[model samples]
Target chain A: MTTSVNPLWRFRGVAGTAWFAMVYLYLPILILIVLSFNANKVATIWSGFSLQWYSVVLDNPNIMRAAKNSLIIASCATVVSTVFATLAALAMSGPTFRGQSVINAMLGLPLLAPEIVTAVASLLFFLAIGMELGLLSVLVAHVVFCIPFAYMPIRARLEGMDPRYKEAASDLYATPWATFWRITLPLLMPGVVSGAMLAFIISLDDFVITFFVAGAGATTLPVYIFGMIRMGITPEVNAISAMMLLVSILFVILSWLVGRVKQ
Target chain B: MLSASVRRTGLLAPTVITLFVFMVLPMGLMAWMSFLEPGTYGGVQWGHYSAKSYIQFLYEWDLDDQLVLNTDYVGIFLRSFLLAGGATLATLLIGFPTALYIALKDEKARNRWILLISIPFWTNLLVRTFAWMLLLRNGGLAEQFLSSIGLVKEELNILYTPTAVAIGLVYSFLPFMILPIYTSLEKMDWKLVEAAFDLGANRWMAFRRVILPLAMPGIVAGCMLVLIPALGSYFIPELLGGGKSLMIGNLIQNQFGASRNWPFGAALSFALLTVVMVTMIAYNLRFKRAPGADK
Candidate 1:
């Protein structure tokens, strides 16, 4: 109903509840971020702020190595999945074809299936084929897993686009290749970039799939953080986590901006 | 330069092939492995096929080799479902109002609020769950605050309990619930609501007649998103449940890791997959039938 005529009795309560929910979602993360700078080694206690934990995390060779590995895997997965997903999205957004729904389902399956099932199945698949489980295997699995994330944005962008641009290019006697490269590709850049960024973030933040498929020396940051937590909690973990949160937030913002630009 | 058919083939083949090789094949292998016997170690035995794993899900072999009805594993499944259901309900209660609040806000304010929700969604779930552990453990901030406020007299020890697991879960999935319901509410025709009010319907009756049906698709979607993931979640239970409470996810992980029973783990995974797939298909059908549902 109109806000003027019949003010909903629950309006104030709903607004208050919403604010509370937001605080509830963010408070723990805010706590972690603050504690990362705490001078005390203990996680729960609040002492004077210091940059020691951040420095310590930076100096830790194992963490640095794991971070490097994560970068490599995420970059590779992002590029590979973005390419595959773009192509698939392009085809999917084009003329309707027979068995299109089946193809759609296949593309959507990775997202729909539980991560554990995919992780375990990937592990078993690798072992069955006698493939060594390491960075390479993790990369392949990540690319496959990240396809849906990459595809969704690109598909959305394509679907949002007018078909007239492509038709205009072709009507002018431009080759399909030239039309795609000059007309379609440039227009699709925002979607491709956003899709790649999303894929990178998904690959970077992934733990369950990476944990299952990763062998010794193949640990990503999340898996490494899991190991550290399993050993015991410390401020170092907080520092790294805070760092990760910053990066993920940055990527998300970048992707959001890219999507906004397309509009 | 390329024909349409060729262009389509060239574009789509790589993803199809990749998905087939990695996604479909692995699932097929897991299905095949479920019927096979476990090796002495972790891998499956090639030719020793049996229905043992499926039977083991419901019946355990005793010392006397008797087929005993095993309620233990069934209990674990039920517990997982109950916890997931609880988490879904909790998130819905919180998220419905949050989504409605956001939907009612101005465009600029709505975007900022939505961004706030997305930040947590993108944050590493393990880190978030760890923060919960830090808060919920004995003598932690939660306990200190509660006691300081006279809400409780003793230290909080919710860290390793099922309640802690539920809290972690609802926290993890609240955004999934919020975003979808917000989409529905934001796009809804408020004029209909006003018309109902003008036609002599009370606020509750107006909402029941106009708003709830419009929001049902989003509610259903949000419920599925939260529930399915919660059911299969291993980390929350592992971290918050103190490795004591076991869900089907943990059970499946154990079958592969500690138990070294590949067949059994595959069976458990396949079962979970079946349940999820059915839910997804039902969701897709229902979503398709609903007008203005998210594509």
Candidate 2:
């Protein structure tokens, strides 16, 4: 402990800085939430607290449609991404092969590469295949990005698990598939879920790829928010965003709770 | 040997095929497309090829007004990097203490603190960015609260500026930094730490000597994870950036969007990909490592 430095300044400064940073980081979030309840229709001015914005957002058919589209896309993407990721995880950890090095590098590409690159490629791919840019396109595109997130934590979980148990199951008359289906999947559930959750979250928020790959009629929520954004700041955007924040926070909380319960 | 090999291959077949088609093929095609010209109908224009599209962007299309063209791209690229780099540095600085505090604390504290850190990750990035838009805009909370006092007289619009963009980028990406650093810090060897302290090193010295080096891999991983994609972030700068300037992401988007010059955009995309791939290769070279290496 240095006696030369004043304890009071150090103490207050550290606490103050930390508190300020946290507040600064979170303040906009708080403000958005607060304004979402504003009774006034206009965003530039505020009247009073109101739940009308929430109702308006909910009551709007477009919002509901976009929400449904998002939910279906996310769920499908999660399942596909989780399944493929498990395969990739098994590949990366189970055995090495000639293609192993190539797969490893490719597995990380989406994680590291720019969204625009893949977004462009996805658009081109669909075009080349004569597939219309619609729900299916977005679903496949989202899944492509989600696989790496799914692969990572699940791989970690597989690595951390006791191999002897798997071996025991294999020795007992359980087929490799059966052992994996029962023991491996069960033990790896948390990582799989975590990965799925991460994948879902990412798919839900992805705008860049979603923006380019989506057709005009298939406007996802993110694309909707982005399109509306060009019109300048408004309360509807705030109201919609606040609702989205709630949706995301809810998913995050659910995932965390699920993780805790399993633990 | 052959039978076991076949067995392993059978087990891994689906993963190999799925990854090859979706992951490997798309990237391969993109790399291939980079060399070719983008067709008008959004496919690659075959047989009309040169590196002209790429060269044009790097040299700013040989402008009459060099300063103006340079400002448009060179300046914007530099600004974007600076902003992303600044955000990365800040995340590291702030995330280090928070991660250390959590990792060093008791079990209860660790759980609570980590939960707090993670709650924000679930919220949509767009929503999160929008939240900042709400706070930073004119007559918003920050401006109103400040002006209500004597801190600011005229209304200050903090939204749609570089600083606002930085705030959103930093806020969004901070967790990526924290998670890895926390992992590294939590996995630090307790005995080495104690040994450093016992060997007459102070807290700062012990930390510097024993903790920082061990955490370098995670730090490097976290920074790479945060900074690379951030350079191509369209939304953060788009909404917060207010369409004021052109980022590489935005530029790529423009070529693909209204500009209708897919070749030029693809060329730029290749530029970003090349930079990222080279850097990642360099990173892996420096640390051809696995987890728990030091341990």
Candidate 3:
């Protein structure tokens, strides 16, 4: 602990500030989670712990439809983006080629561009092309933004991988396709899985772009929750928010774990 | 068996096509839409070039159809800039210490702290903003707690104000600030700090001269990350500001949704994009990254 030498003088209140900051960060989330289980109709008041709110969420037809839409969109977005990202990562992993920097910048553009801008642009694009703004439009938008998220982890994983294994396989007269299948793919699975998980969560949790692009009958969970929130808070909103938080947190942790696992 | 170059081309095709069609093409269309006349109903009028959308940012047509300077849209842009700037500063003040504390920790504890920080970031932005809505509303937890503690008699009346929106922005983007600063500080060479101390530099001096310069790259990155999103945030200002305070985002949405002015909305997006790009380019030029800090 070299830092212990000046802890008292140098970073006087930093540790305390970190503690306070953590509490500040988690308190609202914790309160929301706890209140989600409250038996009372009012969201803030506590009568007793109850599972009725969760049941109410499950029973609500609008929420269920939104949830179904969310899952379908997230799944399709995750699969498509991850596959495209995996292909891009595989190609870009080999060597620096002409226009590599340009390609890299383009890939990151979706991430760097403001969501509101992208949403507005996408809305205009769909309208200009005479494409109906529905599930398909939202899906197209999700896959676009999600590609960079899916690409980054996979690219990182490939960068960390020992390339000699693939070389050694190819040197043994194994075909390029065989070497990719037998050697590279297994090595990249963790990155691929983690990337897919990240894409899924991002798509599932998206609000801004989805809100703009989604037309009638194409509401996702976050969009539905936003509407619910606008209408006013209820115990049901809390429950659904809690559940959504759980899903995202679980996936993040799972992605972290997968990222840490030995390749 | 495919050649490596052939495989590269094949593998890269999807990404190129997807980005070109969806990202580049849409952005181009938006740029064009920003110049075209807005349609009566909603969309833009094709081939009708008009700079009125851009001009309308500072000027509006009066009864005589003459351009008159209007600060309404500019006011929203200014408010958004100030709010985003304030949020960036707040996050830095809070996040720097948090990041420094984590960076000082040993490996196991460091990982735990990082994960804790990341969870909130990965969580839904709407949910996080909504949580603030619960706390800041009239008679909500914050106000109730203040009253319960005999702090005040009157209502807090913080919700639906710019202050509430500021709080949400700081809270939502704190992690973005922390993570980048942590990334930089984590890779810092602590020996530099020790050398400064050994050379008779006091704690504050060491921090100012040695530690801060090293963390500059991260700080800059964190500021950009926070500023950009904070500038464009719709939900935080919408739900928290209660429509009293309008940021660039809500203003743009209003143009599209209720005002039915697609060209103006697209123009606002371009204006926002220009601000963002200028910030990014200026920062990149000013802050030459510390060598090996990323490693």
Question: How much TM-score does chain B earn in each model?
Answer: 0.97, 0.87, 0.97
Interface RMSD of 3: 1.5
Clashing pairs in 3: none
Question: What overall lDDT goes with each candidate model?
Answer: 0.89, 0.76, 0.89
Q: Show model 2 residue runs off by greater than 4 Å.
A: A1-18, A170-172, A175-178, B1-7, B35-44, B59-71, B290-295
Cα-lDDT of candidate 2: 0.76
Model 1, residue B253: C-alpha shift (Å):
0.9
| Candidate 3 docking class | medium
Per-prediction DockQ: 0.67, 0.42, 0.71
Q: Estimate, for each residue in B1-295, the C-alpha lDDT of model 1 and write its tens digit.
A: 4688888989899999999999999999999999998899778889999999999989999999999999888899999999999999999999998998888777888999999898888878988898887889887779978998999898777888899999999999999999999988888988888778789988779778888899998999899989989988989999889876478889988987788999999999999999999988888876867897876
DockQ of candidate 3, scored on C-alphas against the true complex (2 decimals): 0.71
lDDT of 3 by residue, B129-209 (tens): 888877887767888899999996888899899998999899999999999999888888888888898899988998999
How many backbone clashes does every candidate have?
A: 0, 0, 0
What value does the lDDT take at residue A226 in candidate 1? 92
Query: How do the residues A51-90 of candidate 1 rate in per-residue lDDT, one tens digit apiece?
Result: 9999999999999999999999999999999999999999
Over 4 Å off in model 3, which ranges?
A: A1-10, A258-263, B1-3, B288-290, B293-295
